[model samples]
Target: SDQISKDESMVGFVDDLQFFIDNRDGETVVGLKQKLEICGRGAAFNDAKKKKELFAKLLMRFERFSSAQQLFAYIMAAIHETFDTKIIPSTSSLSTQEIDAMIEAEIVDKIMAEIGEGSDHMTLNRTHIKGMIYWLADKCYVRWHCD
Candidate 1:
């Protein structure tokens, strides 16, 4: 059974490659590798919907074919954003604005701490930070458009 499952997975991977080659113009072997890397990281997400959404975005971005390292960075960022928001209180005594700020700070600090171990790119803009927060909220990690 395990051998059969492995064979099935291999067949599925081959089918994915065929689909990519047929549809994505200008995609190269390197692009496929990047896609695989992105897909592998995205598969770690526990939520299927979020995983699909994330892979869609990653695939769109993969056309440009940046390093797999960058894709990994985004994956880590998403994981951190989702995990952090999931732990935040859904209903807080603080004002919505205050809670939003706190969430942002917590995310930034966590991302920084994780990345600080090696990477130099520690800065996240307000818009990007807000986008992560909104993404988490949309995933039901917190109240949407509330704190």
Candidate 2:
């Protein structure tokens, strides 16, 4: 499930995540924060240039990985394993941008808020936004290169 589906590049970041989390010793903490700052740069869309670069890169990178099963799997994973989502809005109205936001912003915020600072709790749930979050997480964390 964590395998970036068909295109292995999607999971490139995921492979690095556990390693990054594991190696969080005293000295390397600053580097970790800096990497995370870069990791999280495109989140708010503050400037047009960075936002465009981020989206363009993602699209070019993930275009081939786009498939019905992958999308379904991503949705299912996030919903079932990661976060609690409410289905007030219908799927028909869902856009790529909104789904991206859920994965990039809301899920991380929700977990961080619930777990508090420096908490390692994996308190995820089956809710409305899980599906979107998983897909987005995979996109963010997974790499584009395959061995």
Best by lDDT: 1
Model 1 error, position 127 (Å): 3.3
Compose the digit string of candidate 2's lDDT tens values, residues 11-108: 33333223322332333223222322443433333333343345335434544332323433443343334332432132235554564465445454
Pairs with steric clashes in candidate 1: none
Clashes of each: 0, 21
Each model's RMSD to truth, in Å? Answer: 15.5, 16.5
What TM-score would candidate 1 get against the native? Answer: 0.35
- Stretches of candidate 1 off by over 4 Å are 1-59, 63-87, 116-126, 144-147
**lDDT tens digits, residues 73-98, model 1?**
46334544454564344424455466
Count backbone clashes in candidate 1. Answer: 0
lDDT (Cα atoms) of all candidates against the true structure: 0.39, 0.35
Error of 2 at 118 (Å): 2.6
